[model samples]
Target: MNHAIDSITDGTTYRTGNPEATWRHMRAHAPVHWHEPGLFPGFWSLTRYDEVKAVLRDAETFSSASGILLRPLAQGEDPGSDRTLALSAPARHSALRGAIAQWFAPRNLRLLGEHLDGVAKAVVGDALAAGHVDFVTDVAAGLPVEVVCAFLDIPVADRPDIVAWTTDAFCAGSAEERSLAHLQILDYFGELAEERRARPGDDLVSVLARVRFQGALLPMEDVVLNCDNLLVGGTENVRLAMSGGMLALLEHPAQWAALREDFAHTAPTAVDEILRWTSSATHVMRRATRDVVLGGRQVRAGDRVVCWLASANRDAAHFPDPDTFDVRRTPNRHLALGAGPHYCVGTQLAKLEITAVLREFFTQVGEVAPAGTPERLESIVVNGLRSLPLHLTPRTG
Candidate 1:
């Protein structure tokens, strides 16, 4: 526990670099060890797969109302102020998820299939046309934004601005930058919400604008906040999954060739493996509601517990040869998209997006290799590449 605490306080141990070794060490030695980083409140780390899953499932004991981020809340900032599906308590979270569940139903997602197929074709075609491109911007980031925008009924002209605001809000930004971006996003959504309210349409915004809770239309703030959540969650997870998936494929050519040869059969499994290997949305925190014993350690009431999804996905106890990237790995119940009640509502859409990307890659691109080194996002919150330079060869057929 002392060594674990020392490693965590070093800061680099969690934020940057490959922390798998660090997590592997912690999982073996201190599955539920406490650390006092001094920069913020002391908290416990849950590195083992079972322990992390337990915390996620027992949200009644480990509440998310304290906020999911490990950073301390600013003075006077109400925990519930920014409550969306991810941060809300059980009842409220259920209500919020229920309101939008139909939008992401399998039938609705299937309706978008042709549209998403067109988007994927265009994204892949454009990247190939460019010959050498930043895959992150040129390919990975394009489809999800378009898909979400189409679903939300956002105007085409507004997408670049929305993407900028969302990227700043979710990735890395100074406090003022994030504050300004947040205000801009809210202002845009506020105006859009009013328009949707006045003239309802067959879109997510209209659906949210009309959703009622307790015999009354849901509040505008909740509508806009959840819209923001959908954008951030939908955009970031899929984008990183595809970008990181491409990197993984390039790094393992045999797996890439295997996928390319039998894309129809392997794409789904490949998508799941990519999700496991990337494991973006690195860690989410919860506060202990009362004193409890976890992993043979006493956790005090009101203590913050950080669960590393990235680490859990790589756990050897659960995954066979966890380090190896096997696209056909079966029985893969990885927690990349999370677990239990708060499991990603966007799972179906995400799978579709990644699957499309892979299938399109095999169908269109003959060969893709790294043009230069990919840059890692410096933040610990999301495990993804900041940029990926790739040389592409289009398929002749």
Candidate 2:
């Protein structure tokens, strides 16, 4: 059967196409539909909540060793496929994730929150003081990179280039540009890893440089690749989520008022709702390790399967009024950060960043209105805003 949507593999389709409508139609008619090869490889698309959750949970059945994005790998292989955390097999993935998990753990976040609160105040205050600002670049993009760089202990002098390289690595216009950016990041981290080896600090790169896996220190290649992983993942997800959440609030005035009225009480649920509404990490791909029947369709061994997290977050069967932007949404078990073992390592950090900024916005800003057209990123992998201009009015006594 012909799907109503344009090719999901094409980046331009995400920039211009109406994917939400198509995802809705597919959820009802074809939850486990297959797309013939087009711009990328052929793959099974899962749109429903249950199906997507199940695939993410059973990583042994649906492996991440093939790579996560929909992009075609060179010669059908990724060099970091089973070595890096995001693309590793379950056994090694556990060890790799455990090495740096302490930094993102609850105790660490509690200490980190104090600093992030201050950062949030400064970031939001600057935007409010500006009167009118591009929320995407001026407000949303600043905090996540700062937090991530702090974890990596990146020097203040080097951050500008790091931020630019990260943007190119994930959202560049061409494949060559993205690859070049990746190489630059890997090289930068490689040099940093060498320094950390000689004189380890308390930062994440130092931990990676010193940590052992399988009774041996991790290889320099894994150290550098994981650093690239942390940088890209840490920066992109929260940046897009913040921008999308702000746009959602601007569009829904009543919800905004409700949040601003009692931010302390409302912030927790609001952050989750924002995550669900934004669904920044759009989809994750896995390769089937065994033939299995899913959603009344047979998936063969080695076939690629793409689970649309954005679509699952909006599946009507799980979420009541799935499309509505409600801030106080409870029992919201959205798959925005994913599910099961491969759940986002930076889940707590993402929440803290969103909550920090929103809290300051609610307390300090009396009004926020869209000032211009919002430009979205042209990528199927990330639901992101390139620019969101907004007019802000600071609260006055």
Candidate 3:
């Protein structure tokens, strides 16, 4: 599946055998190349580290309000129709972000340590009980959804449906199917929002329901959209990161041994390395607010700029031996979670989830080996495994 460097069809899949080569080629020859119209529309591709950061940091110049995906809006859609932080004006985005910031702040996330520990124990315990499992669904996807449910105070019975809705919304599906899933999400969250309004709890929904934005409660649309964002972000990113992280460790036995040796000292750096090495967020799009010169290429107003975060994380200029998977790597400031204004809001939560799960996994499970071929999700946005069959070997005294 070696795609042409100039083909718009290249965007169909995250990689083509060796994606690094494709990125390297673009970084060297076409750092700010134009990807002609295809499934979506023509856009500029930024492959270098500095170039990607430049666009992300200069949000005023390259806006997200228009939308982040390269695809044009469906009929009757406005610039801020979504109203999520990823698709809202700075002022609106600030209010929404501030409302949820307290819940995800490091201090607040620490309070969930015991709860996360229990979730991790159960996830790994089930795998241990089974002896073999689909690590993607069984192990990687557990803690993320559980943590979200805990925050939203969603009941255990309802968690599975929410997870299914989010998974279908993001993973492989037809546009109509995806739209129906999204609508179902909005309907479910909308009903929950009303419930919170009636009897306010300490969860996110209640906060959003009561919290004043611009001296008034947040509109139902914004609340639903942002909640949708949180659910999708909460479930998808860390789930993929964990699945990808495990795959990375399995592929690199030395790194796995290092993680198993001293998780406390090594987990932090290893997690950062995992985020960098398995850059699950392949790319994000930004629309140029006005004419701007980027990496020697001229970007006009309303022009789409595709920042390849995955490529930037592997840029040779910033990272030495960028392709190698080294868990001990330091000063690893990767753009995997993004940077500046539109940087992922669920970052701290993700860090906590990844660290806890990885620590517990290494501590409980003795060794992991591939039982069958892992199937990658066929998505341009999501770099994740749909199924990862693994044979587990538990620790024995």
Give the TM-score of each candidate.
0.92, 0.94, 0.93
Candidate 2, residues 178-290: lDDT per residue as tens digits? 88998999999999999998999999999989878779988898889888888888888998999899899888989988988888898899999999999999999999999
The local distance difference test score of model 3 is 0.82
Q: Model 3: per-residue lDDT, tens digit, 174-204?
A: 8778778878988999999889888999999
Off by over 4 Å in 1: 1-16, 73-82, 167-182
lDDT (10s digit) by residue, model 1, range 222-290: 778778778878988888889999999889989988988898898888999999999988888898999
Angstrom error at residue 207, model 2: 1.6
lDDT of each: 0.83, 0.88, 0.82
Top candidate (lDDT): 2
Error of 1 at 85 (Å): 1.2
Clashing pairs in 1: none
